[model samples]
Target: MSDKKDPSVWQGFKAFLMRGNVVDLAVAVVVGAAFTNIVNAVVKGMISPVIGAIGTKNLDHYDSCLSATCQGDQGIQIMWGSVLGATLQFLITAAVVYFLMVLPMAKFLARQEARKKAREGTEAAVELTELEVLKEIRDELVARRRSEYGER
Candidate 1:
């Protein structure tokens, strides 16, 4: 067969782009980037000082001399204190999100889903009992038989 591009490929791509999940993912990416700045600010503004009070706030200060001529100005430097501060900030932000946002949202969504399922179950139960459906089928067959025989 001769090679020919399918027009439906573009249509499918367009449909995929328009889907709700893709749109939601795009929004989440933007929002998450914005939220990261806020978290970083909170860490720098609020958490760093409290850590400073503990006198271990700057983890990057720990250094070991690597050379015989290790004068204070010529020695190798390690920046572990800054790293420690960043790690602590990450942990704090994660804890806040877990407790303040994720946990409550998860619980609320679970309850909402449960209530929806219960409503659907109630509606399904009210719609038809097995005996009622069987009766309906039996009546249909009886009417069909009577019609075939031209009975009253």
Candidate 2:
């Protein structure tokens, strides 16, 4: 009988976890949770107050009653202000993450890629020059051999 054991499910799972993308995803989730707190704080502390200056301080309280005998929680209410506040929070978070993190990283990666391409191009140019010189030397040697053989 062969000595090798079949691959187990647990081994495959472990391999998946060890991949770079899985680790990066785990880090991204943790950072995103932390970033959420900052964005929520900014929306609540700064942006909400600015909106409050116009009317109500608490957006949750700013709702419209749709029923005729509407009082307190006894009505079909449209909570547009809460929706607006949530939308604002989402927009601010997206803008900050894009401008502060994604955009700068993209530019930096682009610069690194450009530098890599330039180095490769320089190496290729040097290799091409060397090839041309070798070809010239080979042609000169062939011509000299032909002339000697013709004279003989």
Candidate 3:
């Protein structure tokens, strides 16, 4: 009984990993990490300076002082400006991927699938022609008339 314990759970897990969707997800994760570096570079290199020029010296550095703290204990915080920049970068990356990659790929695949179905339907329809249908109707009518005359 122990030896005969179901292997289905392990088999299902193996099947899940082998599926194209799972493989594609794994690939996307790796590619997304690489793309994140590029997006971060673009945001930090270009957008940060522009924002900094318009505002404070550093976009990523913000400080808040607590109420009546001792001189030595004065709150000097370095709120993550770079993290904010990174967040923006991630948003842009997501938008680009959705519009440029996902949307176009989905549309292309849908069109291809539709075309394949249409071709298959056309091939199936080719077996029945208008002329053949008209001939079948004529033959049926002739047989009916002969049967009527024979009955008389």
User: Model 1, poorest ten-residue lDDT window?
Assistant: 1-10
Worst window of 10 by summed lDDT in candidate 2: 1-10
Clashing pairs in 1: 58-81, 59-80, 59-81, 60-79, 60-80, 60-81, 60-82
lDDT of 2 by residue, 1-152 (tens): 13343356667888999999999999999999999999999988998888899987778878788888668778798998899888998999999999999999999999999999999999999999999999999999999999999999
Error of 3 at 132 (Å): 6.6
| lDDT, candidate 2, at 10 | 62
Q: Alpha-carbon error at 30 in model 3, in Å?
A: 1.1
Whole-model lDDT for model 1 versus the true structure? 0.79
- Candidate 2, which segments miss by more than 4 Å at Cα? 1-7
**Pairwise TM-score winner, candidates 2 and 3:** 2
Instruction: Please give the clash total of every predicted structure, in order.
Output: 7, 0, 1
RMSD of each: 6.2, 3.1, 4.5
Model 3, residue 127: distance off in Å is 5.8
Q: Model 1, range 1-152, lDDT digits (tens) per residue?
A: 12344557767888999999999999989987887898888877777668778764454654556667667688665656776777876897788789988999999999999999999988888776866898999999999999989965
Q: Which has the greatest lDDT?
A: 2
lDDT of 3 by residue, 68-136 (tens): 552455655545665676678778888878998999999999999999999988876875675688889
State the lDDT at 16 in candidate 2: 99
Model 2 score (lDDT):
0.91
